[model samples]
Target: MSDSENPVDIFRGFLQVLKSFQILIILTALTGLALLVTNGMIDGDWGRLSGGWANVKIFLSESLPLDWQVIEARSYPVCEQEIEFFCSTAYIGMLETIKIAFVATVFGFIGAILLSSLAARNLSPTWLSILVRIILSALRSLPSLIWAILFVIVVGLGPLAGVLAMTFYTIGYLGKLQYEAIEGMESAPLEASRATGLSHPEIFTNVVIPQTGNHLLSQMMFMFEYNVRHGTVIGIVGAGGIGYFINNYLKLFMYSRVFSLLIIIFVVVVIIDLLSMAIRSFVNDQGDVRRPSWFTVLLPAKNAVEIHHGSAGEEES
Candidate 1:
């Protein structure tokens, strides 16, 4: 039989067509589901959506040149006013937001370190690990916004509520990340520690923690950065931050002040991102070459010495 008419070729072609049809069906189903959700639950109207776009076009046409020119002409005065506002109100709000994030992250990191150690499959009993995994998973499933709303009701609307929400969310997030890091650690060091008749805690402190210190630090920095952004969002529900002011500005239609606040937020986030990057780079570079005092604080001096000796013995053997 010709190649085109061969049974094997026909079967392969049929399978390819079946696969393509399956993918098409999946895409169609997803599109239909999205439409249904938007229409039924969200009350989305395509006509209104189009009208909104038209309104945006009109606003852009009207505001682009004349309004922009006016703002530019009075830019110096506007800048002075914004700077004063920043110094008086926005700066304090920003600082409070940072404080909330820092405190929450610290508490969360400590909790995560404890929970992750027990959650790790290689470190703890199977039952304990499964239970911790379930708890962390449940915590992680809830968004920070929901937690913030609940806390707002309980605590009566403040940064305290934000702190609690962030702390719980961070624990779940960091616990999962850290446990995976612990589980992925080199088996050799752990084996050596066990062979040396070290206790579980001793092996974990000396080998697992030191090996995964950089990963933990990186995860902490990431969580802190995320919390900073999320902290602003949680404030929208009166949990306390720059978002409270943003909501106020929106209510009053104070677009210029809102724009200024956005710029300040952008600058702050950028600075934080850069600082985190620098710190991560420093950790990666100095982590192995020389154990910094901070590193020893986590893995004590005696433990470090013992680990070094163990590694040397392993190499010799």
Candidate 2:
């Protein structure tokens, strides 16, 4: 009957949890299999054909000379000369990449605020929260590549297409992330704001928005990082960036140029990582893992307080 000898309670709890999880797992697996079969992915013709994988490998070995060019034997001066083209194109491409990411992050951050404010379960009505959630979901359902492709068609290539595509895509994704962050926040401060005759909009601006700004900015940085990675490939769809260099060099079988462009991308990503980390460290106040979502926004209003009758229950334990 003692706590240490609670075998019956443990057995029943474990069995119920296991049974529930087993049912969920089985349904997920069956649905996955059904989708594969419905899509013809389970067709024997698709799997039975070994195709020309082996033949293609043999053909390449036969066609290409075994004693063909080596990097050391090829003119070192000529290799160095080729490297310059990659560096130049890659530098310009990298700059454009930064521009696209900046636009995307900025746009998404603004959009996240508006959407997240409306979607906040504590600060907004159920209808507003649901509407914001639906809008965010619709925006996020499509990959950024589709936006990039669509913009490429409308804008006719260049960084403009890349920027627009990345911007809208970021808005959709960040809006949802920020909304969830807001919902996960502690309700005490918001409730205090509400108790003081602060309107929903006022509570959001004074309490929720201020508290969540850092989390929002962190999400924006994450979105920016994603944009930097994705924006490069969007150029493949005629949205000008490093992907264009990759495509052009790959088509001509210029692995050296491709390699150089890849190096440029790595350098840019490294720089972005360093900058973002520094900014985050500077903005973060509490330095705790479980930071309140709206802490950054509240930093500015540190002296501001909402009078409440009894807040002892809500204080940190």
Candidate 3:
């Protein structure tokens, strides 16, 4: 039979066309739903959307010439340093936010590592994995803002509250990422370790961690950056950070000052993104999207070399 006329070939082509048509239908339905939601949100007043540009123009006019005064020392504090920027509200708030994020990320990373090990099916029993996943889901269900408000009420308003809130959220978020990474690991080493009667702790530490080291590092860095951005939200609830100043400025209708603080935050977040990229480069020679789990790391040197060459040879075909 000719290639195109073969029953298998015709069936495969039909399936491919059906798949493309299904994708197009899904996209069309999603677009229609989005439009419906937008209409509902505007209450049929689409004209309001046209006025949005005017409102934006007015906001820009009021906020432009970004206030450099925010970086100057406050009147009450009595500046101790020769450089005034150190004592400024912007600096103090940003520094506090960074500190809270750092501490929370560290604590959360440790807690997530423990919880994820238990949550991963490869490492723990099915019942234990489900229980731990339920716990993580509970933590993640409430956002950092709600957690911050709760902590603020319990601990009083400060960076301490921010730290606690972010820590809990980070644990949930990072635990999900960690356990998934662990579960995605190749089963060869795990099976071998089990056959040799290695302890759970030994298998986890010696086999699982090394296999997913790059993924763990990348997830931790991402969580740290996530926590940093969330600091502003938590701080708005009196959890202490740059967002505290931002909230105050908003209340006082000082848009220029708020804009200035946002600029500072943008700069800080950009720096953090760059730093995260650099740190991930240590484990991931490839880009962020292609973090291959290095399971061969668990094999003996000779076996690892053979596997590497074998994979490379296969790829050439």
Off by over 4 Å in 3: 1-29, 40-43, 287-317
On residues 209-297, what C-alpha lDDT tens digit does candidate 3 reach at each position?
A: 88898899889888887887888888899999999998999999899999999888889888987887787677765574533239777
Q: How much does candidate 2 score in TM-score?
A: 0.65
Model 1, range 5-82, lDDT digits (tens) per residue? 999999999988988799788999999998998898657666777679888886556433322121222323345544
Candidate 3, run of 10 with poorest lDDT? 284-293
| Number of the predicted model whose lDDT against the real structure is largest | 3
As for TM-score, the candidate ahead, 2 or 3, is: 3
Write one digit per residue (lDDT tens) for candidate 2, span 220-294.
777887888887789788887768767876777766566656666777778777777777775577465433335
Cand. 1 Cα-lDDT:
0.80
lDDT of 2 at 260: 58
For model 2, name the residue pairs that clash: 210-297, 210-298, 211-294, 211-295, 212-293, 212-294
TM-score of each: 0.66, 0.65, 0.82
RMSD of 2: 12.0
